[model samples]
Target: MDNTRLPLLSTETPLRADAVRNRARLLEAAARLSAEHGAAAITMESVAAAAGVGKGTVSRRFGDRNGLLQALLDHAEQGFQASFLSGPPPLGPGADPAARLRAFGPALLHHQRANRDLYLAAEPAPDRRFLVPAGRLRHTHVAVLVRAILPDADADLLAHTLLSSVDVVLVDHLLRGHGMSLDRVEAGWHDLVDRLLP
Candidate 1:
């Protein structure tokens, strides 16, 4: 499937059959609507109609728009995690932690940009509110390498700094205004990470 972000649903356990179906319908509808009209155009009623299900089903499954966005974010996060943990060599498990952390940002930006509507709609009230878990995942993933290299610098801070180097605002600005190419962005990130990590 051409998923921008993969399933970030709860991994606590399996969901009920009906819930599973409803959830699937919701995602399909959200993806389609977000693509056509952008994230703002996707309403509960609209999603329900598109899914061929009841509005109540969508509301019950996701609570409200914010809740639905959160669920979608979770799914995307889970998909990202699952892929990195096992998908491929550079993006997955086989690369150096520091190197991998540097690589992840551009991929994430591209991923987010592709699903612009869903991403914009799902942005948290404050970045800290939603980015915490995602940050945690990236921080720890890089911390492993930090400990191996510096071992003296605070790994947590190092991770945070490394991550901040790829802020979307900066990326967007660089790309749109400065006419920076993706390869340049990726190369810049490489330089940024190398300097930040040490």
Candidate 2:
């Protein structure tokens, strides 16, 4: 068990430990509001009220609503990244590369589903979508695994293809418009991986 606390943000000016905890608390409150009432329900004032802080505190921490939302997304992304990077089992460090590759899809699917509203609301313009840090990180991780499993293949391109298959927007459409279950989506990932393995 790695006990290291991953920094939520990179900063030249280090935040006091208390400040870090306070910001996390506000983000947690905002996430709770988002989960319970939807992204539309999370406002600066509402987050402040939920965190038992003054609205000014929220303002100081995030600058504005968009900044707050971006931070919330980053906070969520960091946890998901950490789970695959260092946490236990097939999703994390302990499992073989092939097993980890198979696990990535379902892990990502659930992460996106849990954060669906926020992801959809904060979605960048189509041209900008693949450029986001979180998306890039996931792609890089997948590519690394693909390279390990199929060194002769174009892992970079294949990673994109694999990720696109379970893309959040596509999954939402399948789940909502086509009534496709997540289990089916996850199974599809496993099937794809099995076919790709030589």
Candidate 3:
């Protein structure tokens, strides 16, 4: 993937140094609350109390509960994005497209599993689903890889299909509802990729 061509996933305006620190502090507090109690425990008031800030500050930083949750999810996604976009080896830029594509599914599954609660909580409405910056980035990365590996394929649609196979909601359902192991889910990803390759 050409890092230069990637979209800026964050829509927020740049903040001053202290404002950036304050936002990070708030997100950290929210994450701690989620870790300790669960996503439901992370309200504006709760985060405010945890971060030793007033409720108004939380409100100003993140418009509402949903916005706060989205911001928190974005915060968590940054590391995963960095890993695939610029970090070393198979998941990153140095490896072949096929290898990167193969590595993406398990990495995504693990990431979603790690932050399942926040993702589930912040799941966007169906109409606006694909508009999320993180989702767009994932799709773009996958499409780029697919286009490279299968030059004649419809990379855009193929990318969506591939991503849909490992979507967090579906994976969560398979895990919690149907009693599937994470290994099985990951194996399924490898199988899908194997079948797709020549």
Model 2 root mean square deviation, Cα atoms:
7.1
* Candidate 2 residue pairs in clash (backbone atoms < 3 Å): none
lDDT tens per residue, model 3, 1-198: 777544453334454566789999999999888877878898999999999999999999899998999899989899899999998979999999999999999999988887789999878899988998999999999999999999999999999999999999999999999999999999999999999997
Worst 10 residues of 1 by lDDT: 4-13
The per-residue C-alpha lDDT of model 3 at residue 2 equals: 75
The per-model lDDT (C-alpha) reads 0.71, 0.92, 0.92
The C-alpha stretches of model 1 lying farther than 4 A from their native spots are 1-15, 115-131, 149-154, 172-183, 194-198
Tens digits of per-residue lDDT, candidate 2, 107-188, equal 9999898788889988889899999989999999999999999999999999999999999999999999999999999999
Q: Compute the lDDT of residue 153 as modeled in candidate 3.
A: 94
RMSD of each: 8.8, 7.1, 8.0
| Candidate number that wins on lDDT, 1 or 2 | 2
- Name the runs in model 3 displaced over 4 angstroms: 1-15, 52-56
Candidate 2 wrong stretches, greater than 4 Å: 1-15
Assess the local accuracy of residue 53 in candidate 1 as a C-alpha lDDT between 0 and 100: 86
